[model samples]
Target: MSFDSANLERAAAWLAQIARQRLTARAGQLVETDLGAFDYYEDGSWLAHLLRRHQPSGEEFGILMLALSPHICPHLLDTVIAEVRPEGGELPELGGVRAAGHRAMLPTGETAQFFFSGMNMSRRFDIEGMFLADHWFARDRILWLESVREGEPLMSGRLIVNPEIIEELVTGKIGRPAFSMDFPAEHIETAMDWDDLVLNPLTRAQIREIEHWVKHNDTLMDDWGMRKRVKPGYRALFYGPPGTGKTLTAMLLGKHTGKDVFRVDLSRVVSKYIGETEKNLSRLFDKAENKNWILFFDEADALFSKRTDVRDAHDKYANQEVAYLLQRIEGYNGLVILASNQRANIDDAFVRRLQAIIPFPMPQQEERYEIWRRTFPEQIALAGDVDWRQIAARHELTGANILNVTHFCAIEALAKQTREVDLRCLEEAIKREYVKEGRVM
Candidate 1:
């Protein structure tokens, strides 16, 4: 996937040739250019591999090259356009706009039309087909036409290539995107493995079933020809008490199945303005649709809660948001996991649509004992009198609480200049956890 300047150079040359020929033809002159002689498909470079796989038409290749030329050869289009119009006047047929801080002319949908179809309005439809919603470029989120002002022609929008795709073409890999208002989801990972997770047999079995869907649902739907009958994506509900390994289980699921897990930030997702919630979620789902990513909607009740009777305008729009979310999640092609403290918080409509609802109850005494035994770091030592069994039997602490207590004990031991966490330290740490939870020891 290394960047190959030669491929980009060849593409730029081809596009430049097309621009010259089209401009000449439009200027009351006949131009015969054998564009078919161009050979851009011969190599092991990233662009060549992409061209070979997608096999775009000559005109479609020109559009892609034009979109990419901004990054690789910034002055390519500017030079060609300047040659065509030496008087330094704008050409409306070659649609483009000057971007802030960029000296070169950025291509727009109209620019693509001019390059490919020239003055032939009939052939413009053929160029339009390349930007259709179902097209590979759009579906894969590689490139698209940006939104334009209301009443403006769609072709007037800027032709945008995805930054990730550009990075892949320039660099060897695509880095994880940063979490922001636009994305509203964070890429989450864990070094812990499945063996580290302690779940009940029922929950474990249910999780295994989800893993099956992640690993082989493609085969069942495509190879087995069940796509027409079965839904496109897998929807699962993970509900239980906080700190009961809900999030950890999700991270572990992604780890075992080799899929990235993204936790949607509800605070960023739910907006006060009308239609904003749907807009935010739409951006999230649109970016995630083609990526086989596991969307972990933690504390999902804020967005997917039970809808209320329409008592006010707020209530009606809230219900509409829920409806929109349902449609979006159901249509998503990958796994969607909604994690909440309780199943009752989610709407019954969502519950009915869920393929699996797995509960992560608080750990039992035995599980808590195991958690306590494994919670402490390997470098830390437990005092001889620190009876973990009795501690687990007496105090009910979730895995997260156990880790918190262990962290406190480790810090206390370090403060006292000791290598060991004594039973008294453990007791004090456990008491602090209870106090934080408003529970009496």
Candidate 2:
């Protein structure tokens, strides 16, 4: 409820600037001036909350979302930046990041027509300035970003601010702000089936289907007159044997798209408390909706397993979890992957929404042989008499299994002061891997 002398000074200075701007300005009004157009939203909310011991209201909230919108309409950012001219205080800058990169500044009066646009906007590249502004005077502040992009002929303007990108933008030097979360930059969508990753024609075809939906450009599928997304985008179900590349495929896709992939920890996501599962799923979906990340749920048969008759309370709750999961999967705007070894275990209701379904079955003999051969480094010293066919005939390992066995074999060969993996050592690893699976070695 009380602020230090410095805090009082900031709040005073900020409030003074808010009074200077007309917060009710409509979208048609061109923002060409000072902090007067921007109301102090976020900082004000925190102040009011601290004072009243409750949540802030109006322009006090949604500051982060407003600052991040990609195409802000009617020059809202332009107005905000004009107002933010070198206030007495400046924010801290991490190494190599400019002042603008850290936060954005804008005027308070720039809402109205851009209300919805600003509410969800986020993540525009270089930040320009940052200032706290309020929308409607319900006692709160909103953080605003000030930046611009090159515009096309539709408006005959050089500046373009996107309102669509509202979610990932953060203001101020605060650590771990929701808008500052880093989306992972790797995934399986980048797999070049024929050129980079070795795969059979069928696998390549399936990859093409996924790629088509992913908006792969080289194929020109969009301009080629296809009216719809090949598979569209729904949470997909990938099932088969492990090491058959289910995880690899997911990672490849994420990597290709320059998005992060997050594998949900079902243990943390599913809870015994009522509505806990829905809450957890909602949080993940909300995060993924705005952030650049692919949600992957591996070994998901436990979470997404078929629902049985609700005779018991446990069964009823389990069914509720399934229903919640289905809704989340359908609502997610980006790609989601659920992988399980037991395809039969997934409920039929859940299965119907998959945009693309691909099996990662255990490799056939030919594929297995190719996997084994590729598993080793090209320059490894070979006895020249290595029989891949014989090895393939003898080993029942999947690509992942083969990769493990070969990696171990290579290390063992090195330990033995030999450049090439010997049949004896290779057999030892293969036997160990097979025994783990309860197969006769």
Candidate 3:
């Protein structure tokens, strides 16, 4: 049978059995109760028909599954279906099952007090309830339900299952939460390595440490329990001037370690509302917790700046935000790189929490020469008049600046209808870059 058909049959059979048992028990008839044979509907075949009938869109089903899987269980789902599907009715209500108590007559001749009791015994009981209560489930707004009525011991809310959950259950793959303002791996896969990066001794050592941490993270934390004694995460600071390769280094670290680099957009994270920033950050950290992604905060001074005296409400809230960030940073077991233009701009207290603080200084003349030479594509012919030493010495540019100059020179050479990048073109490009920076060439 095909995937959908198979699941549909399984769901129909499972639900039919549940419905028969439910009806028989209601009529005070003997019900077979062997739960060993009735395996937990692991494949989510039980909801396949209901989902197909209600939500025909496949993409919608996938999305709903991504959001609901973390908060749903098979027994709860079965109970929900049983409550809505009447004995001889048409389609059941798609809104959700009412949180009314429904007894499950087990196949082993044992009575489960409530259908939800079976759900409670699966994996982690009431864990989803805690997650739902704390997090804003309404934000996804896929699973809408009524508020629990007073004196109702059972949860009275409606449990609207999204098509995504059904799809996931059928496929057996739980999707990650769709978090806003966080870049995923696919977004940064095309990031180029800094071939011209001139790493000093200290920087090299720090990079090694980061690599070791990533490789042996589980051993140190789980096997050794070092994480329990100290902060679980490796926090580092990349402080340097613009165009000095801080951002590139972070990306390279992620690439080398086979981890995704999520560059946090501080503009989106730091909000004007009091608690909103924390809420946004909480969502980010929570989603990224177990996912081995390196959290890269570029231009981190904006958020990690020194705490000021509380002259007003803004200052107090700002400090509170910093404190909350510190807590989250300490709790995270993965790698987090905070890139800042100036180390002084970052808080002293925050700096104390770091495992490494590698400074990215401006490339020296020799390094600059290397950068200029390496950055120039071998495909592009260099004119005999083009002087690498003169260019590198005269214009003390960062690796990034050198790249920009090379690109402009190439384009200029192309525009002039020449394959060779001549001295005039290179000089003019370098001069233009300096001029753009508000500096006299």
Candidate 4:
């Protein structure tokens, strides 16, 4: 007593009727909406599905349209619909809500029997009741209720979906809307030239490498075998003193790659309750599929600390958490950057996973000079007598401190009613920095 044939026949007969009624409507009104287009797409069943979702008075009005499918009697579907119209523009429940198919509601929540001709497949996180497709936005993604693997042949063979391909489609280091379906206005990105933007103060070569990777990571991943292989990505560790452009480099990389750079908000990921942190991270990855994102964990050492000799439950659970994180990170398909001021705090196992450990050493004398010469824009006028070289040499501060001193000098020089920065004003800025750092400059 296979219901498969009976169910499909009932559903097909239902859809053929819909096509005939739509034809009677004034031209150019049909096929105007996602629902309309979907109803008309290969079969009108999709519209039937939507109607079932809303469950309005005349589910049969939409159900009748399904008759248009080649296999159904279109004329009979139209006849049934014409016979049931309420004269006073009234709405009522159509009889025979039941079909000879699967025990599914017709989107009407009316316990209407639905025949599913196609197979539906989805994964659950066993413990967490989350959908794998939750990682995608509905507008940008096209989700098929049934598996297309057994369906008609395509330009490429039947588009059989496997976990490998879906996972590839779901994970990214940087991303723009899962292959460019119209995204929301809020998600749309505004373009900026990382190189031409004057406000950024990162080094040319380092910035260029980040940019090149952003622009050509497809080639890199393919060459490195990360595309098809199950390997943890070669990590790139960024180490430096605070406020010296490490964060800026990461953000610029996201801008270059056409995706959002998310600073993994630690508050959201870390929890006081045991095993909660791992679960939180799992949800984050589930929601981040294929949107080539730059995930920045600013202070990575909190999670990547060295393993300890276990004596208590706390110690064992902590080690388990680390192990779980390593597994998830290895499987992650996007760009991963961990930034920290104290590199020594990160465990060797974590360090070994890194592909590039770029040390952001404090700027040298010449680099510091460029930092000064370029820091003040041409919009602001300075006296020709002001010496940038003297400032860079005398300050001997980190690049960030130099920027601060330059900022103060600009304010002070302007207030003195002079366009040119005076030696005295610059000296005052240097003195303040010396006091803050407790240096004998």
TM-score, cand. 4 vs. native: 0.57
> Distance from true position, residue 366, model 1, in Å?
1.6
- What's the lDDT for residue 122 in model 1? 70
- Compared with the true structure, what per-residue lDDT tens digits does model 1 show for residues 279-350? 999999987876899999999999889999999999999999999999999999999999999899999999
Off by over 4 Å in 2: 1-200, 216-232
Q: Is candidate 3 or candidate 4 better by lDDT?
A: 3
The best-first sequence of candidates by lDDT reads: 1, 3, 2, 4
TM-score comparison, 1 vs 2, better candidate: 1
lDDT (Cα, tens digit) per residue for candidate 4, span 170-286: 241123334211211112233434432322234446556666666666776677676665453335778877756676677767776666876766666777789888887776665
Candidate 4 local distance difference test against the native: 0.52
- Candidate 4: Cα lDDT at 214: 62
Question: How much lDDT does each candidate structure score?
Answer: 0.86, 0.55, 0.64, 0.52
Q: What is the lDDT of candidate 3?
A: 0.64
What order do you get sorting by TM-score, best first? 1, 3, 2, 4
Quote the positional error of residue 202 for candidate 1 in Å: 1.2
For model 1, what is the alpha-carbon lDDT of residue 255? 91
| TM-score: model 2 vs. ground truth | 0.60
* Model 3, span 1-441: residue lDDT tens: 334445444434554454445443533333444333222233345344335435423223322332243243335434544565545342221113323354321111011112212222341233234225443333333343344568843333434544454555455544544435552222243356645467665776778888888899788777888866776779999988899888888888888888877788888888999998898888777667756778888889888999999999999999999999989988786888999999999999889999999989888788788888888878789889988898778887887888899899778777878788888878888888888888888
lDDT by residue for model 2 (1-441), tens: 322223333544444334234333342333233322223334443333333443433233333323322222223343443565335333211001123542434322233213312222231110111231232221222222233345621111111122222221222112222322232212224334433344555765776676555555324434664435543244677888877877777777766666666777777677789888777777666546534467788888878888899899988888988998887777665678889998898888988888667777777788878887777887567665568888898777788788788788778777887788667777888888888888898
Worst 10 residues of 2 by lDDT: 123-132
Model 1: runs farther than 4 Å from truth? 26-38, 41-45, 84-90, 378-384
Show model 4 residue runs off by greater than 4 Å.
1-114, 117-210, 219-226, 230-234, 383-385, 438-440
Pitting candidate 2 against candidate 3, the one with the higher lDDT is 3
